[model samples]
Target chain A: DAGVTQSPTHLIKTRGQQVTLRCSPKSGHDTVSWYQQALGQGPQFIFQYYEEEERQRGNFPDRFSGHQFPNYSSELNVNALLLGDSALYLCASSFTVQGYQETQYFGPGTRLLVL
Target chain B: AQTVTQSQPEMSVQEAETVTLSCTYDTSESNYYLFWYKQPPSRQMILVIRQEAYKQQNATENRFSVNFQKAAKSFSLKISDSQLGDTAMYFCALKRSSRALNFGKGTSLLVTP
Candidate 1:
């Protein structure tokens, strides 16, 4: 069984540009969460999606938004990106809010570099 | 709001030795869960171990165990017979009931051969 998978392992973008990163949740998983990990720091929660709607969000601004499809795959879209937006975007999947271990399995992450 | 903290920025251990990583969290809710996740150079977050707040018995995996002190809100991870492959960034996370996890800054573990 495949774990969570993310597309475009790496990306480069200019300031003010928009980018969309994709993620496919692990098989049998129903919740998807997005996080931003800056260099030398921990992953910060961006938001979480369940049942095709956003269930929770973090400190991120309106420029950062996400969507969950019927299949539980997710897309993180960033608008008006800044140089500080450059970071590793991680996507995690869990069976559900009440699933075993309350553990989240993460993908390899998309490395975004903004210049 | 819940917060997780890892005071150790980096740690190193000789191969075959053991090491402990410290973590603490703050939450208003009494019922919650704590976890340890390992992120290797490949950047995949793997669940190392977890402990439910109500479980007084510490949670343990094969070579990984957690010293969970519920009263103190402390959860530490101990890696035994450490191997070079064990080197990675370890993050302590907290999740209140029905909430998402709040992760710590992460401790980078280096197991030297």
Candidate 2:
């Protein structure tokens, strides 16, 4: 069984530009969540997608958006990227078993560098 | 809003020895979950162990274990027989029902020979 997989192991974008990172969740998983890990810091949740709709979101601004396809794959889009947007974007997948307390397995993450 | 804190920014331990990392979180929810994730140089987030709020026995996985103090709002991770592979950035996270996980700044652990 394959674990969560992310595309474009690394990406570089300029300021004011937009970028999209892709993720294929683990097999048998339906929920996808995105997180941002800055240098020397832990990951901060961006948002979660369930049933092709955003289920939960963190304090991120509107510029950060995501979508979940029918196949349970996800894409995270960041518009008007700033220098601070440079960080490791991580994707985690989980199967919502009992409503909560599900174990989330993560991907290798896409390193985004906003130049 | 809930907040998780890892006071120790860095920790070191000799190979085959033991080391403890501290964490504390602020939350008002009665039912929730706590987790420890390890991120190595490769940058993959690996779940080390987890604990449910209602459970009192604590959670353990191999050489990794958690000391959960509900009243004190403290969750600390202990790694026994530390090896070089154990070196990584350890993050403490808290998640309430149907909520996103709130993670601490993380503590970097380095195991040396």
Candidate 3:
């Protein structure tokens, strides 16, 4: 079975520009989550989508948004990109059984660089 | 709010040897989860092992094992008989009851042959 797959392995954008990253969740998974991993730091949760609705969000600002399709594919959108926004964006998916105990499977991630 | 910490930035071990990476976290939730993920040069985040907060026994998978101390909020990973293929950046993460994770800065492990 194919694991989670992300599009555009690497991306480059300029300040004040907007960018979108895509992710396909693992087969048989329903929930999708996005994370940002800065150099020398661990991944931080950005937001999570379940049933095509934004169920929960992290500490990120309104500039970061996401969407989950019926097929469980997800897209992350960043508006007004900043140089600080350059990081490895990871997508994780998990099966929500009985509403608890989540084991997330992660994608390779999309490397974003804002110049 | 929860936070994970990995004090060691980098560590090196000889092939066939054993090494341990340290991690600690702060959380008030009674039930949660902890995980260790390995990111190799390929940059794929692979799940190494996980420990549930309520489980008293540590979680183990093959040569990978964890020493989980719930009271102290400590979760350390031990890799036995390390191999050159074990080189990677290891991250410690915490999943609260709310299901979002808080992660540590990560420790880079290098296995020399």
Candidate 4:
């Protein structure tokens, strides 16, 4: 039983460039959500993907987008990255059946550094 | 929009002692879920414990427990017999229905032996 897994443990990008981070949700899970944790701060929700479609989003702008594949894996894409985009990008997974009560298991997270 | 707040930025406790982290949240929804997640130096978010709005009994997991006050909108985590491994950044989060979790700034706990 593998937990949620993320690719490219770390990434480095520059302004105006785009980057894509990958995530494989825990086995038996379907919903995937992305979050950004800045230095010395808690994670802020980026968006959520369910049924291969974006279900809910946070205060993030259009530049932040995500996709949920049929296999329940997910990818978070950030376009035109800014220096402020540097943060730890976290992926969490849970089953929709339990709804809000479902415990969300997280991955190790990809550390993104925007220059 | 719902919001979670952790007033304490940092706290310290000696090994084998107990420590409590404070959290407060604002939400109009009568029914929701509250959670405490611990992120250590490794940066993995680990669920410590959770409380349901409708449940009167506080949630507990091993040495970790929560004091949930629905009317006061307060949720505090108490760690007993703390160890060095207990040191981490603890975040308080709130969720309603199918919405994404709203997390507080977090409180950094340091356990010293």
Candidate 5:
């Protein structure tokens, strides 16, 4: 009955460094999505994964990528990060059904700071 | 491309008072969904309410309700009996069919005593 969970609640990395953040979807959920929320702004979608494959992506660059495991967990990897990359990384999960609410329940999020 | 706009950058209301946050989205899809999400200092994105574009009756949950105007592409959230616990950033989001959510910049709400 646990909700979505994320690891490394807070991270500090330097520019040009690489970091990987992990997320575990809620029980019985199949879809996972990643978002980046800069300070004082709403979260912007990064990508979505279903069935271990990326289904949709946002306007992010090649430095950002993600993977979904068979167990519905996900990892977001950012390479050669820049200072602007510092933001709160949020992971959300949803149960995909024909008539269900399809609401994306979110985790507490990982705050990444690139120096 | 879809755009969600929240003109209100910040708002404050006394405890037990009611406040409304305005949101407007642009989309041609007749069947879509609008949502209100609350993010507290803890930084957890909580789903407050949802309204399907086709449902004209609006959606309500406890003290939260949405005034959804499909023709105008406007979805406003009203929080009744506001509590200090309700102070947070409220985001308006829109999703078409099964795509990802498009969110507004968000409105920071403060419920004062």
Candidate 6:
């Protein structure tokens, strides 16, 4: 089975531009989450989507949003991006099961450079 | 929300040697999960080991094991017989009912020959 896959492995955009990163979840998985990792820092949770709805979110601003498609894929969008938006965007997917601990599997992240 | 802390910013080990990375977390929720993820140059976060809060026995996966001290809120990862491929940025994370993770700053581990 193919693991989680992210598109546009590397992207470069100027400040105030919009960017969208795509992620395809692993086979048989239904939950998708997005995270941002700054240089030399751990990932910061952006948001999580489940069942085509946002189920949880972190401290990110409204400019950062996400969507979960019916096929369990996800997209993270950042509008009017600033230079600080430059970071590695990571996508993780997990199988949600009631009463079972979920282990998240991640994809090789998309590196976004905001100039 | 949970807060995870990885104290060691960097660590090194000789090939075939062992190294331990320390982590502590603060959380009010009794039901939670802890995890160690390794990110090499490839940039994919790979789960090395995991432990559930209610489980007293430590969690182990081959060369990787966790020393989970619930009372102290400490979870340390120990890698035995380390190899050059073990070099990576190791992250400690916590997750509650929301399923969103709180990650630590991470410890950069280097295993040299």
What TM-score between 0 and 1 does chain B of candidate 1 receive?
0.97
> How far does residue A63 in candidate 4 sit from its true spot (Å)?
1.1
Q: Is the docking of candidate 3 incorrect, acceptable, medium or high quality?
A: medium
The candidate maximizing DockQ is 2
Q: Which pairs of residues have clashing backbones in candidate 1?
A: none
DockQ of every candidate: 0.65, 0.81, 0.77, 0.77, 0.68, 0.70
lDDT of 1 by residue, B11-90 (tens): 99999999999999998798899999999988888999989899999999999999998888899999999999999999
Could you tell which candidate, 1 or 6, scores higher by lDDT? Answer: 6
Counted clashes in each candidate structure: 0, 0, 0, 0, 0, 0
lDDT of 2 at B29: 93
Better of 1 and 2 by lDDT: 2
Off by over 4 Å in 3: none
Among all candidates shown, the one with the greatest lDDT:
5
Clashes of 1: 0
Worst 10 residues of 6 chain A by lDDT: A95-104
DockQ of 6: 0.70
Looking at model 4, residue B43 earns an lDDT score of 92
Place model 1 in a CAPRI quality band: medium
lDDT of 2 by residue, A1-115 (tens): 9999999999999999999999999999999999999999889999999889999998899999999999999999999999999999999999887666278889999999988
RMSD of 1: 1.7
**TM-score computed on alpha carbons, candidate 4:** 0.97
Error of 6 at B73 (Å): 0.5
TM-score of 5: 0.97
User: lDDT by residue for model 4 over B59-89, one digit each (tens)?
Assistant: 9999999999999999999999999999999
Query: Interface RMSD (Å) of model 1?
Result: 2.5
Evaluated at residue B10, the lDDT of candidate 2 is 93
Scored against the native two-chain complex, candidate 1 gets a DockQ of: 0.65
DockQ ranking, best first: 2, 3, 4, 6, 5, 1
Model 4: DockQ score:
0.77
Please report, as a residue range, the 10-residue window in candidate 5 chain A with the lowest summed lDDT: A94-103
